[model samples]
Target: MKTKLVLNFNPEASNLPITHNLIAEYGLLVNILRAEIDEIGGKMVIEVSGDDDSTNKGVEYLKKAGVGVRPFKEGVRRNDEICTHCGVCVSICPTSALILDHETRKVTFVEEKCVACGVCIDACPPRAMEILI
Candidate 1:
């Protein structure tokens, strides 16, 4: 199973080798989408791929390690009024969530496919894609 998680690390938990343990011990593939940390602690957006049991175990492990785990629901949002549909975000979207409609020559934002990487936010010529998370 593939799970998208938002991890909150406290000051003590931030000092641990959490990612290394998740990969070596739980055997899960971890892809960090976005992260912000400091001496006090911070948050990270990560995508984990593994079997159902392993994924569940990984979450439990994070919880036991004093890290708060939550699902990632917020994603990129496009403001149609501001968007010019120039398709500038098409090539930059890592998940292909932003695409250009060949026939209509318009840009489309697929929220379900977006990983909230925030790449499109800066790549957008009109600044249409905004990361709410």
Candidate 2:
């Protein structure tokens, strides 16, 4: 089965030296399917697909490096009220997570398709995209 790992970085860990090593050593092995950072919140969400052992190893490494790691819940959606439907976010989404509903003519986001790249969030003019964690 595929495992999804999400890590939250504390402010101190952001500038810590071991952070780079943890990513370089462990992150390089895993699939690293998706990654996203919340600039405002100073948090990061990373998804990886692998067996339980590898996932555990990665999380252990991150913890040893002083980074906070956690498992993420699925089925998160965006708030339509703040969405402008400008369509700018659609193109920038590498995973095609966000799309314009043809019939509704409104923007829609699929949680599974999102790799948490955060590109759409950056592209969103109104900052409508949110991580439901």
Candidate 3:
């Protein structure tokens, strides 16, 4: 099974080799989708693939290590009604999930490619983008 998680790190947790331990100690594949952590602390988005037991244990290990872990239930959602097709989000999307259709001059959201990074949510002028998790 594959699971997506959002990790909140404090200064102490930031210093730890969390991802290394998650892979080496827990026997899981860790793919970091987005990471903003620095010396102080920040958030990270990661996807882990493994058996259910391993995944659960990895989550427990993270929590025990003083890192906050939350399941990323869903990616970003766009409110079509509120969207102006202004294409503000298109330029900022890291995964190219939001695209501007040149012919129609409208923005298109390709949900499959989104990593739920929340960049588009902030850039949207109409406040049409939101993260479901």
- Give the CA lDDT, 0 to 100, for residue 130 in model 2: 69
TM-score for predicted model 1 compared with the true structure: 0.83
* lDDT tens readout by residue for model 1, 1-133: 7788899999998888989999999999999888889887988889999999999999999999999999988767889999999988899888898889999999888877888878888887788778877
Residue 107 miss distance in model 2 (angstroms): 1.8
Off by over 4 Å in 1: none
lDDT of 2 by residue, 94-130 (tens): 7788788889887777777876655665667788776
Q: Alpha carbon lDDT of residue 86, candidate 1?
A: 92
CA lDDT, candidate 2, residue 32: 54
Off by over 4 Å in 2: 8-29, 33-45, 74-77, 131-133
lDDT of candidates 1 onward, in order: 0.88, 0.64, 0.88
State the lDDT of candidate 3 residue by residue for 1-133, as single tens digits: 9888989999888889989999999999999998886777878889999999999999999999999999875668889999999887887888898889989998888876889888887788889988864
